[model samples]
Target: MLTLTSPVETAFHRLPAGVKLGAVALGSVLALQVTSLAGVGLLLAGLAAAYLSQGVVFARAAGRQISGLWPVVAVILVWHGWTGAWAAGAVVSGRMIFAIGLATLATMTTRLEAMLMLAERALQPLARLGINPKAIALAMALVIRFTPVLLDKAAQLVQAWRARSPRRAGARIVLPVALAALDDAEQVAEALRARGGL
Candidate 1:
């Protein structure tokens, strides 16, 4: 979906957004209960099967996204190993990753418009709390719209750093990525303001 525009995405886009969001949320919450490596393994396999059956490019995207969180994973592994809580840490980490992976798959298999609609319906009950569900939905749509843009910018920054690096420091890469992300944020703000969202 990110690399090319395809019919699968178009088909997924026609589904009710609320239904897709519900599925994603339910899958994520349920996945938390599965902590064992075997369970997570099975979940991954299931996701892969679904991805293949649906012809969605989830495996590569999910792998790229998951591997990007290795720093956090590394910290948890070291802390747990040293503190003698490796099993607990592993369970927490696995479940967290599983939820994220499943959620990503859900998004990849669904459409943004459907997601926004689902979010609006889901938030409808909160209207009594002084929340306008439609406004919240629009905000969510804007976030989803920009998430890919930011990701693409980050990828470009990484590639540029790799092209120039002999010894790449974290700060050198992160600083530029952060600045680019902030620029994207400013553009998003400007877009919203121009559309009267501000």
Candidate 2:
């Protein structure tokens, strides 16, 4: 499983993990608040400019991550188009693009350890209500870590399916992807046990 964190260093990478995550969330909220498609498009363009400032390789990596989301974006646009809500489709897809782009940027800039620490700190206040913050934080961190890995796995599965079929294999790989995810979960569980159970 590959990490989503980009190798290209930038000023954003120097910021605190919690700060980056907060910025991502705030950006997403602002993006969603825009009812106009053009507004969301501008937001996306602004994000793209920021990404571009990080250099060509950084921009390309970000582009690939955003492009990987084509399937879901296509569905939203097509469904809205069929339902005679083209504006809604544009706004929805545009919001998704910006939100996903912002998240990808945060993950690319922040290290996994930093993210984990931030999560743990954020959850600590919940411990007063009998919640084990460490355990919850660890779980959240693992999910965040594996999300891109699973996406990469799905992409590989799609590529392999395409190699053997003339038609696009869309949802056909769902079962395999699920099974693979389960296998990953099992491995992570074993690792946690070996590490003395968080």
Candidate 3:
């Protein structure tokens, strides 16, 4: 199968689930300590290397997502530079992006069942707080599973609208897309309930 999950994800999947989670969690924590341009640059370079090492496909996907957000990043950098806070801001932004990319890689590699298992195991200590960890994990898995479906449906609606009219899409198009996606979500929920998900 042509896979959305890249070789990086596949490799991460072989590690114990806890290890994958820890890598992301630890990386996130370390991001806070980066407060210089050098730090941010190094972090970005390392993340790029990691993604590239995974495979061309993963690197492409990561590049596209990062590129799409370049405008936002530029605005942040400019604002911080004006305030003489460029170093701190860049570090914060770079770490957040890099950590997210890594964590996403983990999710792409790990199956839903494995994610749930890890979630359940992690939440075990909190069970005494009246939290149903399994339920929470299952809910998260469902959300993850449906996110891309929702995005694709919305994209399709936008394409259809663009085809029929040359006018720029506005809130009118977005509102209907949201409603349609909700309806699809409802249908999915019904199916899941029938299968004892509820």
User: How well does each candidate superpose onto the true structure, as a TM-score?
Assistant: 0.66, 0.80, 0.80
- State the lDDT of candidate 1 residue by residue for 1-198, as single tens digits: 243223345344455656656777898788777867778677767766755565545445556656777788789889998999888777777767766766666666565666667778779999999889998887776666667877787778777877888666456667777787788778878987898873
lDDT string, candidate 2, 1-198, tens digits: 246888688999999998899999898888878999779878988999999999999999888878988999899989999999999998999988888999999989988888888888888899899899889877877787788889889999999998999998888999999999999999989988998996
Stronger candidate by TM-score (1 vs 2): 2
Q: Which stretches of candidate 2 lie over 4 Å from their true place?
A: 145-187
Enumerate residue pairs that collide in model 1.
17-114, 18-118
Q: What is the lDDT of candidate 2?
A: 0.88
Q: Which candidate is the best by lDDT?
A: 2
By summed lDDT, the worst window of 10 consecutive residues in model 1 runs over 1-10
The true-structure Cα RMSD of candidate 3 reads: 3.1
lDDT of 1 at 128: 95
Q: In the order shown, what is each candidate's alpha-carbon RMSD?
A: 4.3, 3.3, 3.1
